[model samples]
Target: MPTYKQFPLADTAEGLTEADILSWHVKPGDTVAVNQIVVEIETAKAAVELPIPWAGVVTELHVEPGQTVEVGTPILTIDVDPDGAAAPAPAATPAPASSAPAEEEEMKPLVGYGSKAVVTQRRARKGAAPAPAPAAAVAAPPAPAPAPAAPRGGYVPLAKPPVRKLAKDLGVDLHALTGTADGGVITREDVERAANGTPVAAPTVDSGTRERRVPIKGVRKMTAAAMVQSAYTAPHVTEFLTIDVTPMMEFREKLKKSREFAGIKVTPLTFAAKAVCLAAKRTPDINAVWDEEAQEIVYKDYVHLGIAAATPRGLIVPKIRDADSMSLKELAESLTQLTETARAGKTTPADMANGTFTISNIGVFGIDTGTPIINPGESAILALGSIRDTPWVVDGELRVRKVMQLSLSFDHRVIDGQQGSEFLADVGALLADPAMAMTY
Candidate 1:
C-alpha cells in the first residue's frame, strides 16, 4: 500500500501568517529527495524557497502558484512508498451488503514545526456505492441563475493572490477577463478594467484607457502603511540647507582613481553616508527613537544606517548594520552589496529591521529636494539632492562649483530645531571639507 503524505505550509517566520506561492519546482508524479527545494513563496518581507522533508514521489499539488495560503494548509501531497510493488487488481465479484467504516490516518508534522493533523481517509472500493443525498435537500429550489460553466482543465485563471482577492472584492469574474501579463497571467489592472466595465481586450496604451489601478502590496504596501503611521503619529519638522559640495565630489573622484579604491564605484552618496554616520555621533538624539507608550527617549548606541533603494517592486530601505564603525572603504563595499541585494529582491527581513537612521539619495533621480517622511521607529532621515554646477562666492570671487541641497526631516518629539540644525550643519561641514570627518 502507498503511504500518502501531505506537505503543509510551514511558519517561515514569526508574525507571518500567510505566503503567496510564487512558483512550484515539481509537479505531480515527480520524484523528489529529502530537503529538496520544492517551491518558492513570497511573504511580505522577502521571497523564500521551501524544501521537502522526506524523499518521495509527488502525488498531488493541493495549492496553485500565485495563490496565498495560510500556515498549516497542505500545499502538496506525496507517496512515500513509491518503491513498493503495486498490488494485483481485484477480480469482479458480488458486492457485500455492507462495508466497514473507512480508516483515517494522521500525518506526522515536520520537526520543530507544528501543524494541524491532516487526516487522510481511505477511499471507498470502486464497487462501493456513495451514500444517497437527503431527499428533502434534493427537492430544494434551483438557484436564480444557472451556474457558470467551469473552465477547461478546471482552470482557475492565473493571477497573483492579491489580484484574485481584488477581483473578488470588486465583484468581477477573473475568468472572464483576458490577462495582459506574460503567459496569460491576469493582473490587477485587468481586474480593475473588468470592474470598470472596460473591454478586456482593450490596449493598455490606448488613449481611452484613462486611469491605471495598481495593487498596493509587498514593499509598496509596507512603505505606504509606515509613511501614514509616521506622518500622523510623529510631528515632522523639515529643514533644508544648500551647500557647495565641490570638495566632496573631488574627493570621490580621487578615491575612484586610487588603487586603494580601484574597481569600486565611488559616488557623492558614499561621502554623504559617511558624513551622516560621523555627525550622528555629535547629535546622538538624532539617532534615537521616541517611545510614546513608555514616554521615554530610546537612544541607540550603534547605527544600522538605512539606505533608501528603489526596486522594481517598490521603494525598500535595506540597512547596513553597524555603519558607524565601518571605514570609508568598508562602508562603500557594504552600500554596494546592500543596494545590489535590494535591487535583486534578495534582501531579507533582518536587513530591513532595526534601522536607527536613514539616508534617501534623491540625487540619483535628478530631483533637487523634497521633504522626506521619516521611517517608522527612526527619528531622522537625510535627503541628498541633485549636484549641479552653480555660481558660488569663493573668497570674494564668484566661481562655478558643484553645489547640492540637503533636506533633513526629524521627529520634533525627539529632536528640537537647535539640535536638528546643528546635526544638519555638521553633515554639511563634513561634505564641504571631507577631512572634517577625520576629526570626528
Candidate 2:
C-alpha cells in the first residue's frame, strides 16, 4: 500500500517554459523532508532551486543532470507512505472506492509549484490507462509548525534551498537574522548582508583543455536573441566624443573624504550615471522607445538606468529604478548594490526589466571606446572609455590632463543625429565639469 507521488518541474517565474537541470541533491532511496531542495535549475533569466513538498523517501529520478525539461514534466518520484502495508497496486487492479478519499486528501501536490493548470494526477501515457490507487490508504500526520529559532545546523530556515546553500558557503547562520522578504522568507540579500560581503568564487575551467564547447542557454541565449533582433530591426548610429574629465576626477576625490559621502562608494561610473540622468532630461528622445505595433514614439518621464555588468554567467544589465530622482549619494549606493548582486548571480528578472537607458563602462577593462549596441526597449546606450593622461590645451598652455572617450549608440528611427549629438555633448560637459549639473 505504498503511495508513490511524482514531482513535476515547476515554473519558477512568469513565462518560464523550460529549464536546464544544473544539478540534483537527492537520489533513489534517500530520505527527504518537506521544503528540502531536490534540484537546481537554470531558467531563461536566473538560477533557481526547487523544493520538495512531501516528506518521503526518493524512489526514482525521472531526468538526469544536463537535461532540458519543460514545465509540468515529472522529474522525481517519492514514496510518501514507505512503511505502508506493501507495494502499490498494479495498473490493472482498481482500488476500492472507500480508499480514494483518504488517498486524495493526504497526497495532494503542493499548490503553485507546477504549470498554470493544476495537475491533480499524472497524465496517462498514449494508449495506456492510468495507474490505480492502492486498495488501502493511510493519511500521514501533518508536519509540525516551524519554530521561531531553529537550532544551529539543524533548523531548516525560511529560505529557499539555494539561499540556504549560499548562507552555508558564506559561513552565515540563518537562525541569527530575521527574514525581510514577504511572508517572512529569508532572501539571498539577507544572507549576503549577514556574511558581511563575503565574495563568492567563480567557477574555473580546466587550463589543460585546448577548446571547450558550452551550450548556449540561460541568460546568454536570451541576450543573443535580443541583440540580433535589435540589430536587424533598429537602425543604429554611433557617435563618439573625447573630453577632459580632470575636474570631475578631482571632485570625486573630494567627495570621498567629505562626511556626507563617507562609507559610500563614489566611482567614475557613479558620476557617469548621474550625467546620463541629467542629459536624458535635456534630450528626451534618448530615453524613448520605438513602438512598432502602436506606431507611436513613447517618451518616458522617469528614468530606469541600466548598468551593463559582465559576470561569470554572462553579461547582464540590472536597472536602478527611478534613478533620475535620487541624489548622488543614493545613486552611488544603488550602483554598488546592483553590480554586486549581478556579479553574484542574485539579480532577479524583474531587476532587469523595463530599462529606459543603459550605460556600458568599457573603461573598467582598460578599453578606450567602442560602439555599444542599443539595448532592446531602450533607444540609446552610452559607453565610457578609459581615463588616460593625455596632453591637451587648457587656456592656451598644453598640459597633461585626465582625458576620456565617450561613445553613444542610438536607434536612428527614434533619435536623430542632432539629438544624439546633443545628448552625448551634454553628458560629456557634465563629466568635464561636475559643477555644470547645477544648470541642468
Candidate 3:
C-alpha cells in the first residue's frame, strides 16, 4: 500500500496571499528527495523554487502550471510511508513513450512545465479543398488574398493549406506572391526564411475603425487592486539626484569581461541594484517598512531588493531575496531571471509580497527621471534614469560624460527627509564609484 501526504503551499512570507507555480521540476510518479527542487513558484515578493520536504515519489501534481492558488493550498501529494511503495501503479494499457511528439520532448518553460503537444491526427487526401473551411458562421475575407494573376513555373504545387498558413504567419500578401510552385502554389522555403529572420516591414493592417478591447481580469485585475491599495495607503515622497555615473559605467565595462558576468546582461541598472543593497545595509531604517494597524515600523535585517519591471501584463515588483548577501554576479543573475520571468507573466502574488525596497529602471525607456510611487508594504523605491552622453567638466576641463539620475521615493510615515537623503547619498556615492560599495 502507498501512503499519501499532500504538501500545502507555505506562506513564503507574511501577507503573501497567493502565488503561481511557474513550473514543476518533478512530475507525478517521479521520486524526489528532501531538499530537492520540486517546483518554481512566483510570489508577490519573488520567484522561488520550493524544495520537497520528504523523500518520496511525486504521486499527484495537484496544481497546474500557471494556476494561482491561495496560500496553504495543497500543491503536490507525496507518498512517503516507510512500508509504502515509492512509485505509483502503472496504467492498465500504456502507449509507447517514443510516439510522443518531438516538440513536447524539447520543451521550454512555457507558463509552467512544457505544455502537452496537441495532435490533430490526419492524412493527406488528394483533390480535397486544402483545409475544411473555417466554420461558415465564422466571418472573414472571402479569398484571403487576391491570387497572383498567373503561375510562375512548374515547381510542384504545395497545396493551399501550406500557402495560406505561411501567409498568415509571415503576414505576407499571398495573393501578391509570384508562386514558385506548380499550379501557382507557394513553397515552404520562401515562408520559412521570411518568418525566421528579422520581421520584414509588414504591409499596414487596416483596422477599418474596428475597436479592440481587452477585459480587465486575471493579472491585470490583480495589478489594479494592488496599485489602488499602494497609492492610497502609502504617503509617497520622491527625491531626485543627478550624478555623473562615469566610474560605474567603467566598472560595468570591466566586469563584462570577467568570468562572473560572462552570461549576464551587465548594465547600469545592475550597479544601481548593488547601490540599493549597500545603502540599505548602512542605514537599516531606510529599508524598514511601516506597520499599519500596530502603528509601528517593521525593520528587516536582510534586504529583499525588488526590481520594478514592466511586462506585457502590467507593473510587477519581483524581489531579489537576501540582496545584501549576494555578490555582483549573483545579483546580475537574479535580475536577469526576474525580468525573464516577469515577461512570461509567471510572477506570482507571493513573489510581490515582502519587498523591502525597489528599483524601477526608467532608464531602459530613455526617461531622465520621475517620482516613482511606493510599492505597498515597502518603505522606499529608487528609480534609475537613462544613461546618456552629456556635457560635463572633467578635471576642470569640458568633456562629454555618460551621466544618469536617481530618484528615491520613501514613505513619509516611516521615513523622514534626513534618513531618506542619507540613504540616497550613500547610494549616489556607490554609483559615483561602485568599488566603494563593498565598504558600505
By TM-score, who's the top model here?
1
- Model 2, residue pairs in steric clash: 1-86
Better of 2 and 3 by lDDT: 2
lDDT of 2 by residue, 1-440 (tens): 45667677787655878888889999888999999999988778776778898888987776657666777666787777788765544556655655552224333445555334323332233475644454443332212112235356764456654576588789898777676664446778888877886444334557897875666778889889889999999999999999999999999999989999999999899999999999999999999999999999999999999999998878888899999999999999999999889887788877888999999999999999998998899999999999999999999999999999999999999999999999999999999999999999
Tens digit per residue, CA lDDT, model 3, 1-440: 44555565666643556777778998867888877988887655446677765787776675656556666555676666546454533334333443432111111122332232211111212353333333421232222122234444532233344345566777865444444443334556656655565343333446795754443434566667777888899888889898888888888888879886777897777778887888887788888888888988999999888888888656777888998898878888888888888887667655776788888999899999998888777888888989999999989999999888999988888888999999999999999888786686
Positional deviation of residue 335's Cα in model 2 after best superposition, in angstroms: 1.3
lDDT of every predicted structure (CA atoms): 0.80, 0.81, 0.69
Cα error of candidate 3 at position 347, Å: 2.6
Worst 10 residues of 3 by lDDT: 101-110
lDDT of 1 by residue, 66-149 (tens): 676777666787777677665622334432334322223455665544454444333233575643333333432111122246
* Native-referenced Cα lDDT, model 2: 0.81
Give Cα distance to truth, residue 38, candidate 3, Å: 18
Q: Candidate 3: lDDT over CA atoms?
A: 0.69
State residue 440's C-alpha deviation in candidate 3, in Å: 1.6
